[model samples]
Target: MPLQPSSAGTWLRAVLLAGVVVLLVSLIVAIILGASALTGGKQESSPKMLKWKDRGTTRNLQEVILGRCYSYVTAHYPELRDKDCLKIWESLKHAFIYKNPCNITAEDYQPLMELASHPIPCNKSLFWSKTNDLVHRYTKSNHNFLTLEDTLLGYMADRISWCGDPSAPGINYESCPKRSECESNPSSVFWKKASKMFAEAACGVVQVMLNGSVETGAFRSSSIFGSIEISNLNPDKVSAVQIWLMHDIGGPQSESCSGHSIKRLKGVLEERNFKITCEENHRPVQLLQCVNNPDHADCRLCSSNVETP
Candidate 1:
């Protein structure tokens, strides 16, 4: 026989129906949360997109070139005004823009070089091989001496790598060919052209700071100083080449005035009819090194000797 529903049975059926609804709602909420978690994980792992306008390479090129130009002109070259700085930037840009960076040669920078060229005072020029830091410090301390980097163009571009991509609209900040990777890379070409100009301008008793610690001979023929500067020095213009052989105070004095490398350098100068003079452990450079390390034995020796090259 069919059974009639009681109040208790009816209540039990209603309770079961409510429980199913609640469980379904809970499962839907959990699935939504899991999808959100997965999306967040993907976002965190993905690389960020860089906007073209916000590229650091382009911004740095503009700011540093412009700022350095202003400071350099104001301090050393009063003849150049603000307009000249803008011209310099424009000229520099013309060298590699719309061209393959690796294909750029020293000839490509001729326009820029011509525009940026300025006279370096006679006997004020300094050159170096494997002694960039020390030479720069020496130049900075001694107002009488100037290096290629002290000039406007070199000052703006020193220690910077820049290149352009033919396929791209602007400078390639993401990557650039290394000096060893390409013969005519933008950085190498700039320095090569600049060094040639600097060497050409050298006059009177030009100074050269060479590293005494170098095992391969301080004056390598392949170096910028040897290849570019030394070759370009006009015997008629330059009266002498003063070699400052700098050695570390601690020791390992590998190359010096009597070393084979230095002898070769002297021979090269003499062949060109240029008088050569060399001094070992050049005092000014040693003293500068000592300033940072007064406690070192070398610094103590420097104080007693107190000589200049």
Candidate 2:
């Protein structure tokens, strides 16, 4: 007997085919991930921009801004790019010649490097204290007196001078002891003191990008940091950093930096741009921004938790 095909029967067949396809795709992905794990490959990337940007003197705003400012000014204003940045990048190379190792005597500035996994305890009150401190120094017009980069650079410079043991040889970045102890035996810490710098920088950038400045009474610096202290003169080194308590965070999930933190970063840059390369597997994405932030960033590359491949 010949049976007529029903719509339900045909739908069932299609669904089964789809399931098979999905299972096969999953298998392939699992294999690839296994290979990566076996090779000791990183599951994801850390931003290079953060590392480079975090270098240099905190007081010297010129060096801090130079990396990104040049790219922005150059790409946006071609004549200025030729007159300013091109001259800087070129002359420094052609003129400043150090023949040997001793010439590399100029010390690289480092703010804080974590050697412990302890998360920085931050809420609101602590952040407010820090923000108010910055605001107090402002000339009374802007609530947010410093740019994200400015705050981070300042904090980092202060941190390196205070917390870091430059006398200690730069060996495994993860094994350096932060807080000194007398009777606690030989202890170690990891993940240096860069987190606070990141939180400050990230918050400031977001505020400017969204509101063009910090809004008055938007978020009290105290409320942002809660019980955490943002002091720098303490006898101990900073162990944690958090973004939860930044002042001027007009929440409701701010519309300021909505489209990817990286994009906001790109938008902040204006003229002379540089090659920002982010590669995952066979696929590679390139970004051109006003300035190369590598000099002032906390990580070697700048990437959010968002995964791409």
Candidate 3:
């Protein structure tokens, strides 16, 4: 199924509504705006996806940030499920990163994602090819290895939220016995806790998806939300991850699950320093991996304007 975005003003609102999938793009879009010191009085809606002058260095910094974050998550995955953390971080990442592969644009922002400001020894084979060697050497997949679940742990509610009045609403609960368990008016503590997990998972998945194929900033987020087998649950209560994915792929404004995906895409773009001559039709990018033939020295040069030959 396809996912959608939330009309809600902020990414946080999307979570509260339990919407997921689109967060990947939303987050990337959000960060494009959030990270900036000035939007020229413009709101977070239209973020300028710009590359830094030392794009290569910034790319490396992003990689480092992702690496540290991923390491932290693997170390604490067990702890996350038992408590809170995992879900929120997942939602956070999803809200900002992951995106559809086709919309990926190297035209605008490829240089900044490099491991160095001046590109030294960066081989994008594993990230771009998805081959066995890369998988074995860099986790089962670049997406999983590069991102960390650390952020998900950030949004845990201290108390378990429960809906007391018990009523039915448009949305169904997968696990809760009564609609009141997840009612809207006051909302439920029980539902809130569950929503937290769903939101976090969504966010985490989004981030991972972003880094998975093309966007090498963190690890990678995949378009795996569609393949996730969540049929075993009740139709009523939605899972946190599921909710996040659904909202992410299908937004509040969207009619159904039909939209772009975050599969095999890259967000890496050259920073401002590099001269970027993009095609007429270009979208903001999230990763930056490339396929190439090893014999050519030109392939190694980061400043080589044209696509690798």
- Estimate TM-scores for all models: 0.77, 0.20, 0.17
- Order of models, best lDDT first: 1, 2, 3
Q: Mark the regions of model 2 whose C-alpha exceeds 4 Å error after superposition.
A: 1-3, 6-9, 40-56, 59-86, 89-309
Model 1 lDDT per residue over 70-186, tens place: 888897778865437787888888888766666888888887887778888898998888888988988889888888888888888877767776655657777677766667777
Worst 10 residues of 3 by lDDT: 242-251
Q: Best-fitting candidate, measured by lDDT?
A: 1
Looking at candidate 2, the ten consecutive residues that score lowest on lDDT are: 281-290
Task: Please give, for residues 100-192, the per-residue lDDT of candidate 3 as tens digits.
Answer: 211223321222211111111111111112222322333322433321111322112112111111122211122212333222221222223
The window of 10 residues in a row where model 1 has the poorest summed lDDT is: 47-56
Q: CA shift at 65, candidate 1, in angstroms?
A: 0.9
lDDT of 2 by residue, 238-257 (tens): 22222212212222322222
Give the alpha-carbon lDDT of every model: 0.80, 0.29, 0.25
Q: How far is each candidate from the true structure, as Cα RMSD in Å?
A: 11.2, 26.8, 30.3
What are the clash counts of all predictions, listed in order? 0, 64, 100
Clashes of 3: 100
Error of 2 at 9 (Å): 6.1
